[model samples]
Target: MGNIICSHSLSPLSHSTARCHYLVPTSAYDVFINHRGKDTKQFLASSLYDNLQNRGFRVFLDKSSLRVGQYVPEAITCAIRRAAVHIVILSPNYAESEWCLDELYLLIQTGAPIVPVFWKVRPSEDRMEDENGVYAKDFRKHKKAGKFSTETLEKWRNALRWVSLVEGFISEG
Candidate 1:
C-alpha cells in the first residue's frame, strides 16, 4: 500500500548491488518465500526467488533480502507479515527446524494465500506430504526435548493440518 523500499530503494542498497541486511519491508511485497533452509534454499527457493523478481514481483527472501542482524527471527517475522502471498516449500525436514515451523505458522496466521510445494516427498509415498506432510516425528522430538510449549505445538499442528487441506501445488517427480 505504501511506497516500495528494499535493498534497491534504500541507501547503500540503492548505490550498488551490495544489499543491506534489513528484512522488514518498507512497502507491501508481492510474494514471501517460506522454506527449510537446508531442504530447498539452494534450488527451489533460489530459483523461485530469481524468477519472481525477474517478473517484477516484489519478493522477500531471508537469505537474499535480509540485512545483517543478530535476530534473524525478527526479520523473518517482519517479512512474513507484510508479504502479499507466501510460497511455502514443505520439504522432508521442514518440520525439523523450529524456524521453518514458525514461518509456516506465521504464513497461516497472516491470512496470506500460501502456495505449498512439496520439496522431495513423493505424493504416492505419503498423501498430504506437501500440504501437511509427516511432521509428527519432528514434533515428537520437540515435545521430548521440552523445547516448545503446549500451545505453540498445538498451533504448529493445527497450521500443518489446515495447510494440508488447502488447495496447493504438489511437486511430484
Candidate 2:
C-alpha cells in the first residue's frame, strides 16, 4: 500500500491512537476493510488495519472502528459511504455470509475504488460459473435456504463478477 491520500481534510485526531473519536458518523475514512470475521478478522484483517493505520491512513475495520453502543448497520453504512477506498479480503468463506455480500454490493454501488485481496482463494473461485464454482455453490445454498430473494441473490452474483474482474492482490498462504 503506497501513500493512500484521501481528498477529505484530516481531522485533528486522524492520526491519533484514540480510535473511538473517529467513529462519529460525520468522520471520513481513508480505507474501509470488508471481510468475514471468522475467516480473517483475527489475523489478516487486523494486520492490514494496523499496517494502514501505521502508515497514517484512517481505516475503518468493523471490530476496531465500531463503538460499543453504536448501531452496527448504520455505522458500517456510514463508514462505507465516507471511505475513499475499500479493501475486500476475499477469503475461502467470504461468500457464505449474507452480511459480507451485502457490504460488497453496497461498496460496488458506491463506485468507489476497491482493492480486493484474494486471501487463500483465487479470483477464479469468485467467478459465478453456472455449473461449479465457489460463489456458485454459495449462492445455491442461499437459494435453498429460502431467506434471500432471487433479485438480491442475483445482485450478489453480479457484485462478485464485477469485483473478480478488477486487478487485485493474491495471498495464497
Task: Give the lowest summed-lDDT range of ten residues in model 1.
Answer: 9-18
The count of backbone overlaps in candidate 2 is 0
Candidate 2: list runs displaced more than 4 Å: 1-27
Q: Any idea what lDDT model 1 has?
A: 0.67
Candidate 1 per-residue lDDT over residues 25-74, each given as its tens digit: 35458899988888788888999999999999999888888766435555
Tens digits of per-residue lDDT for model 2, 1-173? 11111112321112122333355544479999999999999999999999999999999998899888876765676687678999999998998887788778878877889999999877878886545866778888988987777776777788888889999999976
**How many angstroms is residue 170 displaced in model 1 relative to the true structure, after the best TM-score fit?**
1.3
What is the C-alpha RMSD, rounded to one decimal, of candidate 1? 9.1
Clashing pairs in 2: none
TM-score of each model, paired residue for residue: 0.76, 0.84
- Total backbone collisions for each predicted model: 4, 0
TM-score of 1: 0.76
